[model samples]
Target: MAALIMVDEPSVQGGRRVSVFRRGREEHLGTAFSDHDVIVFLQAAGLSDPEEVLDDPRWVEWSGGRDWKRPPMR
Candidate 1:
């Protein structure tokens, strides 16, 4: 594992903030508010099939801790 991380913060627009970190360093993975956004982020992170990573139990557990609000698909 490359120490990939995801975190959520309160956004100014009442939406949520989703950040990605790797190797304990913050990565500017961009604004992720939906599954698609996360998938894109994952792809950029190196995974070809984002859903596979999303479906992983380890990722599921980590994502649960973020408490990020998933927005509707755009």
Candidate 2:
């Protein structure tokens, strides 16, 4: 089975950073400033090709909105 990557909603107070976690795990892998950063985090975590992982639904699961660049203020 493919690894499940969970990306939380962006936090405005945190400089619009989003928390990244592996599904079913409590601890987050890291935080990212944008979608591209997500890929870098995943790579640093020893995952497969970052771009491919980000583009694959089987690997990534996003919360709130996918627009990490300018997430809607909540």
Candidate 3:
């Protein structure tokens, strides 16, 4: 039942999505994208610190995790 509430905010389909975070009565929503777009932009702006991720070339996203480690590629 609680999980259903999280899916209320529909994703941008093949684009960015606005998702809400739950914390008591304090709910905060943010954008969720399906690409490495933010990574490049953030990196170019010097905001994506930890050059490891910015230079790895293998990690091409803001997901802050490994690509191969993704869940079932689903």
TM-score of each: 0.54, 0.66, 0.24
Candidate numbers sorted by TM-score from highest down: 2, 1, 3
Q: Which digits, one per residue and each the tens of the lDDT, describe model 3 over residues 1-74?
A: 23201212223343333222235542323333433543444444344453344334333322334222222334
Candidate 3 stretches greater than 4 Å from native: 1-10, 17-35, 48-74
Judged by lDDT against the true structure, how good is candidate 2? 0.65
| Shift of residue 69 alpha carbon in model 1, Å | 4.1
User: Candidate 2: where is the Cα deviation over 4 Å?
Assistant: 1-3, 14-24, 69-74
Worst 10 residues of 2 by lDDT: 13-22
Per-residue error (Å), model 2, residue 66:
1.2
Model 2 lDDT per residue over 1-74, tens place: 64377777767643333334555564566777766777777777787787876757677767666665464568
Screening candidate 1 with a backbone cut-off below 3 angstroms (N, C-alpha, C), the clashing residue pairs are none
Q: lDDT scores for all predictions?
A: 0.57, 0.65, 0.33
RMSD after Cα superposition, model 2 = 3.9
Which residue pairs clash within candidate 3? none
Give the C-alpha lDDT of model 3.
0.33
Candidate scoring better on TM-score of 1 and 3: 1
